[model samples]
Target: MSGQLVRSLLIALATALVAVPLGYFVAPWLGWGVFCLGLGLQLLFHFRNFARLDRWSRHPVVDASLEGEGEWDGVFGRLYRHEKELRQQIAQREQEIAMLIAAGQALTDGVVLLDLEHHILFCNRTAEAQLGLKIEVDRGQSIVNLVRQPEFARYLSDNDFSRPLSLRPERYRERVYAIHVIPYAGSRRLMQIKDVTQEDRLDQTRRDFVANVSHELRTPLTVLAGFLETLQEIELDTEERQRYLQMMSDQAGRMQSIVQDLLTLSSIESAPPPEDEVVDMSRLLDKLRRDAEALSGGRHTVELEIDGKADLLGAEPELVSAFGNLVTNAIRYTPPGGRVRILWNRTPLGAEFAVEDTGPGIDAKHIPRLTERFYRVDRGRSRDSGGTGLGLAIVKHSLGRHQAQLDIRSEVGKGSRFAARFPLHRVIAQG
Candidate 1:
């Protein structure tokens, strides 16, 4: 039995023992008075202990150590230990919750928690930045009313979280995000959001590339087919037949050039880094000048200046391709009688190969995307110049293999300058 129960029994027993003997020895009324007195004393002791326990329950900080019997002190000690354990458990849970919130805030993807009524219960920093949500201001507010996206509101109401919803951020037009909702604890929901703008742009670019290639091939193929039909169906004069056949051959050559450039680009993309070798840039530029002159056909002036560094360490063929592309691009773009200058020299950082032209220059806006594959600032003019629109792109990828960078400067009504910069590690200057 508990100490309190044993003490109560002893008090009752002692009271009865003293009261009964006194009742027999003296007057019965006097014995009854003793019994009442003992009973009152025992009841007072029990009430004081119970009142102390009640006060401690109401105000836990208050000391419950009773001044009375040993049993009451034991009761207060057990209660105090139990209360301490409960408080420690509560503190541990609070710490775990704080850690979870910190981790969620650090995530790149946005996270949002909702109540059964679709109210904003909690959200991370990413959600606030991505979705324009304010946690403190939007708390307890219905999510649909705050986000203001019709698609998202419909998604929430539909209760179908099998598929994710794609949305454009309110502040940015080019950016795209994917929002997904999942059912969670007790009718609450979790919304996860991811940024997929780059992926979306890449997919669109891929589609455009396929379409452009098809259109480019289809034009020449259609002309070749028509010429073949003409050659087979009718017998013409010798001179007339020669002219038609020559035109057909020219068309075939254009198609062949496009195919060759595509193949070159594919090779550059798939091949590993080139084996280290010395490149006699002086010799390479000399040959490139001849080729540019032959291509220009005396229509444009071509010049070369290799006064600085001449030799370098790199893959010879890739470097030749990169330099040749820049030279050819200058020749192709310059109008008749325009001047084209090719220069190779050493700078503080490394070596630079530049192609400057006197033809009509490109706009500042178009300069940034000049090296993108199949990108053209003037589609009609590029086609007329017999360009496949892959020259700059080829230069960029080939130079990348050599750890070089291409810088472009252009102003409309003036001319453009294209430069390839080789870092110090790759430049081996020959005296």
Candidate 2:
């Protein structure tokens, strides 16, 4: 504004100097005409500058870089500075947005942002993989159309969002997701998807395990109760009373076995891992052999083979229980006079304690679940043999504590070999 005022005064002074000379030497009329022409020229220049500024503003995006002299120059410079400031602000906001998106991508749970119209605005990589969505391709598209699940559609449509919705997305590899819809900004929502398949399976397994335990205990208690009622109410001969007492004793023993095994399992699972130490494998196996022979009472032929001299490094009690359980299982499962062999050997991978039994082997289908508590290939036969179904499960847990694995291989009519293989780190070579 100061520059414009100074320039205008200079033009007027120059015009007046020329006009005064014209009026003194020539004519007053000619001096007046020169003054009017000079003023008209000034107005013309002002209008031209205004037109340039107008044209720049008329476009969708204004170019604030128009070069000019005097007042116009200052005006153009200020506009350019303002436009640059606006651009910088926009760039900074975009950078922040990118950082937020990157953080979301690093999360395990899927995150998605939706507009009021249910159009997908943004989604993280987890969301894309978990929900079968293409982050880039699916933007601006209706989320419901892509999901294609009536339950999911209903979940979205429902206004009550106190809890998350859980359902399997059939379109995407039968994955289970816990979807939480959080409403914000009037009608906009943030949808977060969490994959809960493993969690759900564990919950179901726990429920089944608890139910199985109840059923197992109920049967023995019911048997005992019935026998006690019979003994109290009815009179019987000495032999008959002895038989009834013996039957009750057997039922009581069954319940005791179940309780002991359950306690063992619970203790192993709850206790912290045992401190590692060297264990004499030969001595342990010898003790286990003697126990098996006593349990067998010479009915089954028990054999022990020490292939490689390597003492194991682990909790002695756990190792003893694990190895002894395998050996006892062989003795219990095999028929009278069948051979039950216990082998301690060192392989390239590690040392192994394997028990091979000559009995009715397990079916291929039952091998996978043999370690589950109370799971049996033949329940009636297991009970008849005084075998608690938890024996194999205990073996599994004990070996797991030692960082060992149980490999069971069996064939019908042949035999089954249950091997507890220990890693080299757990094996110390002995002379």
**Top-TM-score structure, candidate number:** 2
Error of 1 at 250 (Å): 2.4
lDDT of each residue in 281-315, candidate 2, tens digit only: 88998998999999999999999999989998888
- The Cα local distance difference test for each model comes to 0.87, 0.88
TM-scores, one per candidate: 0.86, 0.88
Writing each residue's lDDT as its tens digit, candidate 1 over 152-182 gives 7888898888889989966776789999988
Query: Which candidate has the top score in lDDT?
Result: 2
Clashes of each: 0, 0
Candidate 2 lowest-lDDT run of ten: 59-68
lDDT of 2: 0.88
Model 1: lDDT of residue 326: 89
